[model samples]
Target: MTSRSRHTAAALALLTLAVACSTGDGAPAAAPSGPPASGRAAKDVHVAFVGAAANLNFSQEMMEGAKYAGQELGADVQVVAPPGPDGQAEVGLFQQVVATAKDGVSVMTLNPELFTRPAADAIAKGVPVVAADVPLAKDSGVTTLVSNDNPAAGAMLADAVLTRLPAGKKGTIVLGVPTPGLPVLEARLKGMKERLLAKNPGLEVLGPFDSKQAPDDNYKAWSGLVRAHSGALAFLDAGDPAAFNLPKIKQETSASWLCAAFDLNDAGLAAIKSGQSVGVADPQHWLKGYVATRLLIERALGKREIPKGFWDSGAAMVTEDNVDEVIARQKGPEARAAWYKKLIDEQFADVQGRMKPLS
Candidate 1:
C-alpha cells in the first residue's frame, strides 16, 4: 500500500479500536466527520505537528498519529519542533512554517500568546490551524483545539494525592511543570490548583516549580523543593514521568511525600509499579493527534463538515491498583499502538463494524 492507502487502512483500524475501548458495555463508537472514499483529495494536504524537541516521546506519538491520518488521506505530513529550550526559537519556527501556507497545521500551542499574531497570519493565508494539548482562543486565527479535559484531569491528580494523604485534613502539595509562563503549563497548573483547592479545603498548593521536563532537572528541582517544604505531604507532577522518579529525593527528605503524575510511559509505569507514585492521569494523547488529523483530513478532502469549535479527546485515570489491567489492554506500535488497540477493542466497535464496508 502507498502511504495514503496505509493511513486510510490505519484510520479504519483506529476507528474500530477507539469505539471498542471507549464504551463500557461494547456499545458502537460514534461516527467521525470523515468516511473512507474511492479517490483522495486532488490537492495534497500538508499537516504539521509542532512542539518541544526535548520531549521527544510525546511529540513523536503525536506525529505518529498525524502520520497515520496523513497516510489515510494522502496528506504530506511534517513534524516540526523547536531545536532547544528557547521559546523564542519556537516562535521563529512557527513563523517559518506559517509562511509556507500549508493546507493544514496542528500545533501544540505551548505559548499561545506569543504565537497568536503569526498564527493569525497563517489562517489569513488559508491554513486551517488546530491547537493541541493547549487551547488558543486568544488566537482568533486558530480554527480548532484538541486537548484533554485538563482541569478534570488535574482534579483526578489531586484526588489521587488526597486519597493517600492523612485522613480528614488537607496538607501542602507541590505542583511541578516544565515552566511557569508557558500557556499549556500554566493551564495545567491552574486546573490542578483549582482541583486541589476545591476537593481538600485543608489542601494547599505550594509550588509550581519549573521541572524543565528533564530527568536530572526533575531530580534537582524536586530535591530542593522537598528540602524547603519538608512538611509537604504530597507531590503532584503535572507534566512528565521524570517527576515521578523522585525516590532518591523522597528517601532523603524528612517528610513522607506521596506522588501523583500525569501520563504513563515506561518510567512513569515503573514508578507506579514500585509504589513510589499513587496514580496517573492519562490524556489519551494518541487520540488527540489522531482525531485532529481526522478532522483536518475530512475538511481537506471535502468528505464531511468541519466543526468550528474544538474537541476534548478526554483523559483516562490510571492508578496503581489498575496499572496492570491498563498495561494488558494494549497492542501494536509501542508509542500509541496499545491505546489505539484498546480504542478499537472497547469504545468504537459499532463504528468498527460500519468501517468494514469501506475497507
Candidate 2:
C-alpha cells in the first residue's frame, strides 16, 4: 500500500477501536420522569451527532462527549462521520440523520454552507438542529452553535509561542492549516498572525500553508515546509494534524524551531510534555460535543428553547506545567466530564445570556 493508504488504514483502525470501546449494551439509560411532546420518555429521545471526519482525534473526543451526555441525560445519541473530510459525504449524513432522528441533530462540518438547506428543512420538520465545532451561517436555520472562539485560540497560541522567543525576534514563524479555506482554521491563522505581528513587528510570518488533512500527507506537507524554512523561529498550525506531525518532523531533523498547534491528540500531548512543542491551544472539543448534545436533549424534553447564536465552549493553552493534568482529564469520558463539570453547570445555567452573536 502507498504511505497515504497505510495512514488511512491506521486511522480507520483506530476509529473502529474507539467506536467498539464506546458501544455499550443496547439498553437505554433510565429516563427522568418526564414526557416529551411526542409523549415518549426522555430516554426515548434520539439525538444524532454528525461529525466532519471519522479519523480526527478531536472529532473522536467530541463523540465521546456526545455519548457521555447521552448516558447522563438518558437520551439516545447516535454518532456518525464521513471516512474523511468530504463535505458532500458529511452533508449527506446530516440529511439522513435529520430524516430519521426523532428529536434533534447536532452537526459539525467544515462546509456549513452546504448544510444550510438540509438544516433548515430539518428544523422546518420539527427536528431541532444545532451546529457544533463549526458555526453555521445565520440564514442556515440552525439556531445555536457550540464551539470555542477560534480567533481567541489563535491569539492564545501566538502568545504561547511569543513567550519562548526573544523580544523583536526577526526570524520567520510559519503557519499551516490541514484544510485550507476552512473558516475556523483560517480564523485561528488570522488571530495568530495578527497577534504575532502586533507583538513583534520584526518577525516575518510565513504562509498559512495548505497542510493536507490525512496523517501521512500532513507530515509530508509540514516536513517539506520545515525543510524549506530551516531558519524559522517557530512553527504553528491551526489544525490537529500538525499537533501530532510537527513534533515528529522536528525530532527527525533535530530542528530548533519551536512547534505548536491547536487541539489535542496523544502525540500532541506527548509533544508538549516532552518539550518538542511550545504548547498547544486546546479548543475543548469534548465540551463542544457535550454542550451541543445536552442542548438538544433539553430541547427535546421541553426544558427550554435551544438558545440562538454562539455558545462559547471555551479554550485553554496546554503546556508542560499542565500537560499532565490535561492528559489525566483525557483518560476517559467520565474524567473529562468531571473536569468540566463546574464550567458546564455555569454555562448551562444561563445559556441565553452567555451566548454571543455569530459575527
Candidate 3:
C-alpha cells in the first residue's frame, strides 16, 4: 500500500479499536492511539537494563534500541535504572532488579567487583545475563559484554590530537579518565598516551586525571592542569559529554590547545559542529543495544545456553568534516525510529515474523 493509504488505515483501525475497549467501570475507556500495541505480553522473555542515571541519554539510547529488539521478538524488556550518577545508588538498583529474578539482565558494570558476585548469584539461579558499556572480566558472572574495542577507541582519540599538533612541537599532554582503574576508560587512556608518546619523544605526559568523568569536576581538573602546565599542548577527554564543554575552557584560558573526545550527545554533537571540540568517538551503541537484546531473546525462545564472550561492537570518529552528518542522523524522533528499524532488521533477521516492539 502507499504510505498515505497505510497511515489512513492505521488511523481508522485505531479509532475502531478504541471504541471496542471499555473502562474499568464498564464505561468506554480512552484507548491509546498510535501505532499498534507492541506484542510484549506474547513472549515470556524478560530483560532488565541497569545503568547509571547521570548518563541518561546514553543509557536511554541503549534501552530504546533494546526495546526495539524486544518488540521485534515480542519479549518484555524491563529497564531498572539507578537514581543518578551515584555509584552507591546504582549498586542498590542492581540489587533490586536482580531480586526480581527476571529472565534476562543486561547491566553496565560501572563497578564490576561490587556487582560480580551478586550478578553471578543471579546467573547461578538461572537468570541469563549480559553486560554493556563495560564488560565483565573472566571471573565475572555475566554471560557476555557488548562493548567497543577500548584500546582502538583510545588510539583514535590520540591520533586526532596528534594530527592537529605542529609536526615538531613537544609539550605535556594530560589524559583525563573517569577513574584510575576502570578497565575500559583506562584502556583508551593508556592506548592514547602510549601511542602519542611513542611517536613524540619530547612530549611529557602530565597524568591520568582521577576525575570521575563528571563535567564540572572534569572542568576543574582539566582547567587546573592547563593552568599549572602553561606548556601543555593537548587534552584528552575519554568521553564526549566532557569534551562538549571544552569551549568554555578555551574561552577562559589564554593558551591554544588541542582536544580529543569520545561519544556523541546533544552537547557533544553541537560542540563538534561549531568547531569548539576537535573529535568525538562513537562505539556504535545503536548496534550494541540491538545485538545484546537479540542474544537474550534467542536463548529464551530456543532454550539455548546464553553466549558468553567479548564482542567489540565497533567505533567511529567524528570530526569537523562529518559532524553535520552525525548530528543530522541523530536529529530527532525520526533518528530513533530509524535506529529501531535497523536493530530489528539486523538482529531479528531470522525471526522476522516474531520480531516486534513493545509500546
Candidate 4:
C-alpha cells in the first residue's frame, strides 16, 4: 500500500481502537494521540525491549541504539525492559504502558507466540509495535520485524565448527545451551544440530546442556558436561554460558577442546582471537536496536514503511581469521553500531534497499 493509505489506515485504527483510559473500561479514553506533545521523542514516548532496563543482555546495545535515535530525533526516549526475560512479564509491562505510553514501541521476543495476542492488543490500543530479535506470529497485525533468521543463524554458527572438523572425521559434539524454552535459541540449536549431523553421519550431537542463565550455573553445566563427555571433539553453543562465560570456564577446564557460541562479550572475543574458542556468531545486536527504533519512530509519526515479512537483521561469524577486524569494530558502542551498519548495507542488500531513509 502507498504511504498515504498506510498512514490513513493506521490513524483510523488508532482512533477507533478501544482505549482503556483511567477507568480501565474497554472504551476510547483520553489517551494522547499522535507524536510527542513537543518533540520527536518526548518523555511521553516510551520504547521497551525484552530484558530488564539494567541487565547486560544484547538489549544494552539496543538501548544504546534507541538513545542514539532519540538524540538525533530531538526526543526523550524512555527505554525499559520486562523485570525478567520471561514473555509474560514482557507482555505485562507492555500492557501497563499501553494505557499511559504515547507514541511508538519495540519489543524483542522472549516468546513470540505469547507476544501475538498482546501485540494485537497494543495495536488495538493504537500503539504501533515492532518485533525485534524474535518475530511475532505471521498473522499478527504488527509488521516490521527487525530480527535474524535464527535457525539460519544457528546453521551458520554450526558451520564455523563443521568446517574446522577434519575431513571425513566426526565425533561427539557437545552443545552448551542457554535456559530452555526460548524460541530463538531453540531455532539456533535446531539449525546447528541438523547441519552438524548432516555433514558427518558419524557425528553425534549431545546435551543442549542447560546454562541456566547465570555465570556460575553455566560454568557448572558446561564443566560437568565436558568431564562426563570426554573425547567430545568440539563443544558448540548458540549463546549464553556457551558464548560469553564459557571462555574462562573452558580455559580453566580444557583449553584444547574446540568450542563455539553465538554473540560476544569482551572476554568471549578475546578467547576467539586467542583461539581458545572456535568463534562467536555476531547477531547484529546494534542493528536490531537501531532498526527497531527507526521503525517505531517512523510508524509512530507516519513516515517509514515496511512489508509484512521480517526485515532479517542478518548474522556473521567471527573466527580467528577475522577476529581482529571484529575487535576493531567493537572498540566502543558507536564503533560497534557503525561497523554493523556498514555490514548491514553490504550483506543485507534487500533490507537496506527497502529501508526508507528516516531523515
In angstroms, the error of model 3 at 168 is 2.9
* 23-68: candidate 1 lDDT, tens digit per residue: 1232222245345542544235555656644354455456556655
> Candidate 3 residues 123-163, lDDT tens each?
78788778887766555556577777788888888778778
Taken over the whole model, the C-alpha lDDT of each candidate is 0.61, 0.82, 0.63, 0.65
In candidate 4 the C-alpha lDDT for residue 83 amounts to 33
Over the full model, what C-alpha lDDT does candidate 2 score relative to the true structure?
A: 0.82
Q: Which structure among the candidates has the greatest TM-score?
A: 2
Sort all candidates by TM-score, best to worst. Answer: 2, 3, 4, 1
Instruction: Quote the positional error of residue 144 for candidate 3 in Å.
Output: 1.3
After superposition, candidate 2 runs with Cα above 4 Å error: 1-39
Stretches of candidate 4 exceeding 4 Å from the true structure: 1-53, 82-89, 113-116, 138-140, 343-359
Say which candidate scores most in lDDT.
Answer: 2
**Candidate number with the higher TM-score (2 or 3):** 2
RMSD of 1: 9.3
Shift of residue 302 alpha carbon in model 2, Å: 1.1
Model 1 misplacement above 4 A:
1-43, 54-57, 72-74, 96-101, 137-140, 251-255, 325-338, 341-359
